[model samples]
Target: MASSSFHAPTLVSILVLLLGNSRAQLTPDFYEDSCPDLLNIVQAQVEIAVQNEKRMGASLLRLFFHDCFVNGCDGSILLDDTPTLIGEKNAAPNANSVRGFEVIDVIKAAVEEACPGVVSCADILAITAKDSVVQLGGPDWEVKLGRRDAMTASQAAANSSIPPPTSNLDQLISKYAAQGLSAQDMVALSGAHTIGQARCTTFRNHIYQETNIDSFFANTRKPNCPGTPGQGDNNLAPLDIQTPTLFDNSYFVNLVAMKGLLHSDQELFNGGSTDAIVQNYSQNPDAFIQDFITAMIKMGDINPLTGSDGEIRTNCRLVN
Candidate 1:
């Protein structure tokens, strides 16, 4: 019987065959194709969408948060048959769908309609994240493409890896670092919370406990959190400071006043290990933007398959 697996030539062999030098390694362009170019085209469309409706920028940011937070940008959450798929909502029953998936779906559908089976959903995610930051008035970061889809989705892994809305500064730092992001990256990425909303459940612990939380903010949140657990998450928790819907560095400004709603946000200003980085970002908007870009680049580089570990998936939904 014949074997049924498909295998591309090894990188070493390919280099030797193509250039007579096995020592030569692949560059980012080696994997470039219609998929990444098509991603650029879709990014343009998202820009237009954000331009028309500013809320779309927050939606895009939410998408990045949900998609990556769930499964490290594997595109598994986008699957119609995901185990945790929440009807048409695209999130866990009480969670939001991160909104931008639909926008990305539109782009994917257009790509498929124009040229069937060309782009990968993983690439779509990477592109959308980079573009969404730009849409939100952040720096435009460069993304290296060719991320293949994962064969499985992990609700456990998602829950395990993602920093909860109530995470302290140290916890947040460790989690991002596991994904190959730095402490600076953690602060910059946390800036994303500046425009998102969390449910009552996500931050309820911080409010009701009265021990880990500041008294004033806890008192304010008590009515919404009910002083109990498992009671809320559907409640809205916006990430932005000035415009809850718009993207700006006001999140940093909010930090200066101790107005951060999420524990993760407050922890940054809690005089802990990461406070200096937070203060630095808060004091300088330009530095925040610069670090945000660098952090995004670092975040995108996390544990991705390259050279040989994974395949270029035809359908963004599953691994080949």
Candidate 2:
């Protein structure tokens, strides 16, 4: 792979020639200053783009799932540090299996056409997710700005950070906690799985052996998720029953129904300590959204580099 090499003087020279700011690094403050309406614009633009794709909701839903599950949506999992083709593919394209980067690429193109280099992909994802929640009729979340991009994506981190569909409540909590999120945040963030789709392979164990899921629902799903090994592609799981495109609390409703597509989801209500909260949210969307917003806010703040920990990235795929 080929990369552009940079030295402080050369970068400064170019910046001085272009924007006349030789001393200032590409900063998150730049986005806030140059594009005051960036978040709203990103939100609207993401909605429009997803509407056109017919898969935006699924994509955004997956992005958030992977983001929170992996490195707490810090954009670290998306970095392609070594630039290896396999690394990029595994870390970038396959992280969430929801095709987030593809949507992001489209959004990036649109943003470039509209605002040039003023917006970062990481920020685009943050704002886009907030709007996606609103699009799905969930609570409105306050997303802070100034998230920098990573130059190198971490495939190792991606593997370790993302949550498998079969993870138990305890495993899920531990992973999210590493990102600075709490158990409640994990439960709420997991609510996002309410609006997407999963392969049968992801939750095969739950159906075939887990004692938690309702036998009736498990039997219903068995024909679709047959035990044949490597037949994972044959099975399908929908995240939301009513409006998969809209982010809401129906996932919890499905959990109570024993219709959760993933074992991890079913585990919450099957026989876990959080079952009551899951049932409560399943029964009340309003309360779910209120808590979901709170959880998302917490998830977004996990391990964030501020006050000198991380640099403000000009490009999301690379570190500044």
Candidate 3:
């Protein structure tokens, strides 16, 4: 028998070609035969979780976004830190902010029992996000599946890639554009804020120092998010004051009224390129829904590891 091994350069070239060909191989019906009930199982679990705590829906949605934005929806964000890996959970953008990991664990367990290793954690995150939005009264979209779990996580990538609450309009646009998202996508996706709450520390600067915010709204939020550090830092406030638990156009409405809880939220409506897009969404709920669905589907298509490129992890937090 001949022992076979390629030179370093030849191996690198082969890997790159494989990865390049693996992109965009996902489809809506990827699991039709392998795991026919995958969507239903995920939906049922997400529904129960959201019913127990409405905030769980928002947390899941944010988790999906954070996961997708960094390293392209490959379940890298779900990995727990190991001796060699620095997981994204403890990164500056995600530390003490992202939640709903246990819900994902529950769903993963149910999925494994039903179909063993057929489904991918990346697909689970995407589908759970869509189901969560629907359960919370938001629009529904068909999620493209077939993504595979990442073998590693990157804390440095998460810290730099995930947009902060303090981003300006240009910074936000550039950040989204880097992920192949448009300004319209940015505005439409920001509507996810309608259902979630932001921590006091996340929005403290906006409530205390920003001039674009409504004085009354700022004053109201000020008490909950004291100017002093470490006081009320973890206190929660609705991103959309009108309907915090409901997924509606109230987030755009809040933006129109200068009541967006975070500086980045308000930046969309602050006399910038995204202003008209925000106004359109604020007034037309149908338009917002359509655009949001389009944007979400596009977002979910980000750099997925398809074909034989990556594995379907039996445990989302640990690669198999």
Question: Which of the numbered candidates is closest to the native, going by highest lDDT?
Answer: 3
Q: Give TM-scores for every candidate, taking all chains together and pairing residue i with residue i.
A: 0.76, 0.78, 0.93
> Model 2: runs farther than 4 Å from truth?
1-32, 53-55, 68-72, 79-96, 232-235, 306-320
User: For candidate 1, what is the TM-score?
Assistant: 0.76
Residues 274-317 of candidate 3 have per-residue lDDT tens digits of 88988889899999999999999999988888877789998999
Ranked candidates, highest lDDT first: 3, 2, 1
Per residue, candidate 1 scores C-alpha lDDT tens digits across 18-57 of 6633223323453355544575577778888787776677
Question: What are the per-model C-alpha RMSD values against the true structure?
Answer: 6.4, 9.0, 4.7
Rank ordering of all candidates by TM-score, starting from the highest = 3, 2, 1
lDDT tens digits, residue span 112-229, model 2: 6667665556566777777776665566756765554444455666677776666888887777777777777777877887666777777788778877666887787778788887
Q: So what's the TM-score on candidate 3?
A: 0.93
Error of 1 at 109 (Å): 1.1
Winner by lDDT between candidate 3 and candidate 2 = 3
